[model samples]
Target: MRIRTAGVVAVLGLALAASGCGDNSKDEPAAKDSPKAASGKLVIWADDKRAAALKPFGEKFGQENGVTVEVQAVSKDLQTNFVTASQQGSGPDVVVGAHDWIGNLVQNGAIDPVQLAAEQKSAFNETAVKAVTFNGQVYGVPYATENIALIRNTELAPEAPKTIEDLVASGKKLKAEKKASEILCLQSGQNGDAYHIYPLYTSAGGYLFGTAANGDYDPKDLGVGKPESIAAFQKIAKLGEKGDGALKRSITGENSIATFTGKKCAYLVSGPWAIADAKKAGIKYDISPVPGFAGGKEAQPFVGVQSFYVAAKGKNKALAQEFVTNYVTKPDLAVALYNAEPRPPALTAAFDQVKGTDPDLAKFSEAGKNGQVLPAIPAMAAIWDPFGKAEAAVIGGADPTKTVTAAGKTISGQIK
Candidate 1:
């Protein structure tokens, strides 16, 4: 449950490294000509965290299908290694990863579109399905979802704020009364986190990319330089250093959860991943949707999905499809995965089974019902650094207009 923002470099660097692996030849039939289900064995790759959880299921599936199943833990550089190995025709039949990797994996010819029945697709959360869909094709079978919401200390702030303005007012009062040392525990750091700050940014009327006719992000219609974005920054500047001082470069991913759990802040904009620390600290807390600016759009966090993709160059294509499309969709498997890593389950039946006992899942899912799926387009690789720097600079008292405009220009030039 590491912060997604901190791993941007490693993820993007791996993607860059993948470009040097040379594209898979469209004419080559190495994998396509392989013995489909006749291989008598199926291999799956997963990170260390989930590999153990998958082993028993793999064994069961293998026994049922009359084949040997292996779930290998490719902990280091899983995605990068998957791609490189895939290109050499020696990768696993299935690989587990984030939905955001769909575009790069598809572009590299490392994974294939998953075929799920219409009823099967309807069994999962709509947002989860959308996150795994790229260019009208579903590339993965989603299992769990994560999104940031407003986690408030109930002892410090008994009621949820109706708007960002109300939250700020309450935070200021808490600071004045010496109940808290910070306003909001949204992580900014020296290098700003677009992920943590995104809900507020959207509420202030900013967007990353405009939607195309297909309802997918249109890289050509960059939103950063537009008029609405500038207007959004004008609102954001009011929450920066010279203003209400809620957002700060001093607060970071490393400390924001700790600050909240330590009762140093009343409100924390974070995901379910932070719940463990809060519980360990023995704090009375409640979760809610991040409030919007009084008159602006509803706050929308990016919905990230964890999924299983069938590798295109797999040795056992039929077995891979069977495991991913059928076995992984079971409620028991989804619940088991959730137990291993406590994110909300993407499967509706599994979530229903668990929500009665764990009400927090319902709250987090409610907060993200309107959230946009984290865009998986390859152009998104160009966004992180410039955009984060501009945000960090603005929060540190730099001119919002000049800084944001420059960032937009730099990003546009980099999006190929």
Candidate 2:
């Protein structure tokens, strides 16, 4: 899929600033509403794409609710701007973003919990809704859900492969015959994409953290270095018999979408974002389940939930809540948003509404039915750097068990 360059750059900047040093102590307390304060205006911070799609809706909501809705398109640094603005007592009343940002946002005390009506709660995928729920409180109203699925060039592989062995064998033959460049292409940048790689790990009976009695992730049970995880990595490392090693992030070049659409790869682990470009390239493609590894369970990727969150500190909490709960939650708007971006809908009605028209989305929805939500706990922040390095080491020919074990230990130690 085509990368939203501006969004990526903005998110990267926020991620960098959030990951590095920051003045947490300087954050201002959330403004408390006095009994007399007016609540006639609501400000919203949204990405350019979402802003363009939702601006009219926002205006309509404002008119219906007798409130002025100010929708600002903040291309990047959402978390940074939200945090900094909240601290300065000048931030939007609501923001649209991924659930993964919960930990950082909560740490900065930049957002508040959202209380959904029973009917509203029932409308969303339970797992998607739960991703934004932290420490026993719901924090966001989910709009969409996304997950990685195994995508193959339909013309090359008319039928989907059922197992890892089947994929490997077919990919090998195609490469040998000069019909394809690589068997599969997965993301492997400076920080290996744990989110994207989760399917392989789960296919081998591996997980990043264990679940508690309540089904929330248990921070103490970090599983990055488990034997199963190692085995999964080992299998992935063996895929592209390139003497060099498993896929490297640097080799992926500037655009991964180009790599797949260019017909250099037969199978790619991607999401809806790539569908538009694949259509542009005139490549016949379809999605399928990720292959299971070593006789383990089916591969399940991390399901990412995108939602709207009202800042606890927002100047227009009442108006923001009314817009989200009353207007944005409707099936029509949800369908519109899903159509614009083409990801599975978190809203159940929206899912049923758009499934027939968008085959790619249907494929993703089916593939992710058994998927797990990526961990949103604060400890998860520690997994990226060291875990990626260990995966790199294994791909670089280091001992699988040792590399993963060391990485796991380092990750466990780093988490507070």
Candidate 3:
């Protein structure tokens, strides 16, 4: 979950990128049409990563329902496009996307609540179901989950760093020995990465939003500028170039993979997405929870679940609901999706099938054992810009207290 929303513009950045694609109208359906227009058809939009895996399942569902089922890859701006298409009544009947889209999709009236039987819901990871629920309504069927963890070059460090200070000390030694060029591979280029830095902030007692009575995130309780947040960043600032030189804005997402793969860094704070590249680079790595500061709490990453949702505006409402809550919830389908991307599956059966088979997967789950469910509230849309900029300033040698305080005010004002 670390840096999951890095560099996002509003809540529209990298976090939702997995929801699907399309940059312009040429790619988007120009007019919304009811799924009713094609009375016997069903469609699902997904990011390219899941399209191939879903095609066979779509064929099976179509065969059973006697309706055509197409799993389309929207590869660009899935969240915005789906809603845009929905307003015009032309969106797909179903969409495979990130759970956090629930709030925005509901706000746009693009999705309907999914009715999962208690027995069926009981088969999923509790955190996953919670991620797709909004205001007490289950809006999506979760299939897979992901969160960032510490991917360390074992040959270099051999053991996981006990604390943030220890990690920095080890990194500095590696740099001094000319064994690496960078201290760490956690990206912070320019705007800074709030997602990646969240654990540190939290370990220092910072929080993004307060919890509502029902355990949902309350945007009204903005914490970006609170005293704890400032103290957290002050600690982070001490690790930057002017201080320990453990972090730098130059290590961006675009370069992080290469930095770690090239042996330019000993540890990379990243998600499962980088595993393949590390293998290709032949780097012997280990996965563990990202360590926290010495005096802080245990590090916690943000938990994100990828899910399937039914479009409220679709013509095949009944069939769409049937596909999402019934068909997509199966353990086999969940495992297939996991095989395609290697993220931990959300289905309890599927998770049990894979956990013992892959130590890496188990490690990620362990790392996020007490992670924050990436808040799905609409107010998250207003937090990215100001908070990210403030983090950038602090990392670049600015005052943590002033920068974090100003960011909190900006977020509160925007929420109001």
Candidate 4:
């Protein structure tokens, strides 16, 4: 993938930060214990991308405050590692994670509620904050947000389809001319991806969880097998059957991007991460909201937010709060982060800065304007497995309604 100029600048900033930063690992003497220092050390665990980006900031913060900052890039399982490390009193002072993981993190007592200043609160996306809120308490600071939208290869279809019928018709045209493999490309592995497929379900007016008085997801009101979900699945099943079941278990994020960029498919439902590759392949594309099904509502994908959370068990809570609230939340930092990664910014001002620069991001923001935040309730852990199986059943030729209904019952029972 060809890296954009903005992306290059972001990477350079991160590289500079990583090299200039001081070691703040536990192995080092506590800065406070050193007579010349002002405070203590702060440890942070982040994914590789974030870790690289934050290294320079860490070095700067450490130097400015006389407190050392340690950054470790843990690639595999953040949640599992956080839980295990916290129990051993060796976890990070702060963690970078997703909002949906709030439920489990809170339940496990692995994170603490963050108390943002009123001004700080105003600077963030309310919906992003709400995603990390559980039982009336806020737990994380969101840095970025994401959602899927319809991305069409302009070479194959110059204009984006406004409805499922339009998408299907375009697909049929491509197939007739042997220009495409299928009308719509979706992932349907044994464990189906309900998150990515959510737009299709919502387009049919189905929802996985109902809302409460406060708009929090009501776990008891499971809607997996709702008539709308079934209808939506049936529509996709019909397309799968007619197209030789091209939407198979093997189809993944990588493959989906390939299909569109390779010009083998006209429309792909994806997020901003695919932009670099799409551009590099020299394929012209435009994004739009996922179209609604017949007699159904507009397709609304689940909105996801990437956030930072203070560790309740951290030894340096005050310093961690200072870093997140004072430094990371600034417009300059926010803009740098967004430009580096190109997801929707949680801060409105920062978001507005680059909103016009990236068309893909703008389309995603539009698509998510009416989208529901993915349920962060702990019960969501039980929904993914069974619901995915039901989607697989539909793709495998079983009745959509029956499969989804069974899956819903199983999920509800497990939660109970």
* Best by the TM-score measure: 3
Show where candidate 2 strays beyond 4 Å. Answer: 1-39, 240-253
lDDT of 3 by residue, 294-354 (tens): 9898888899999999899888887777677667777889989988999999999999988
What does candidate 4's lDDT look like per residue over 1-416, in tens digits?
11111111111212112211122344321112212222367788887777777777777767666666777778878878888888888787899989999998888888887656655667788888777778887778788999888888888899877777778888888999999976776666666788877887777677788989988889988888778677778776765543445456667755878877888788887888888888999988888888877677878888999988888888887677666655667677777678668889998888888877776677788878888898899999989999888876677777887888899889989999
Mark the regions of model 3 whose C-alpha exceeds 4 Å error after superposition: 1-38
Q: Please give the TM-score that candidate 1 achieves against the real structure.
A: 0.90
lDDT of each: 0.85, 0.74, 0.82, 0.76
Best by lDDT: 1
> Ten residues in a row with the worst lDDT in model 4?
1-10
| Candidate 1 vs candidate 4, TM-score winner | 1
Candidate 2 lDDT over 271-326, as tens digits, reads: 88888989999999989988776577888888889989888788877556656665
Backbone clashes, each candidate = 0, 4, 16, 1
Alpha-carbon deviation at 331 in model 1, angstroms: 0.7
What residue runs in model 1 are displaced by over 4 Å at the alpha carbon? 1-38
Show model 4 residue runs off by greater than 4 Å. 1-39, 242-247
C-alpha RMSD by candidate, in order: 8.5, 8.9, 9.6, 7.6
lDDT (0-100) at residue 85 of candidate 1?
92
Question: Between 1 and 2, whose TM-score is larger?
Answer: 1
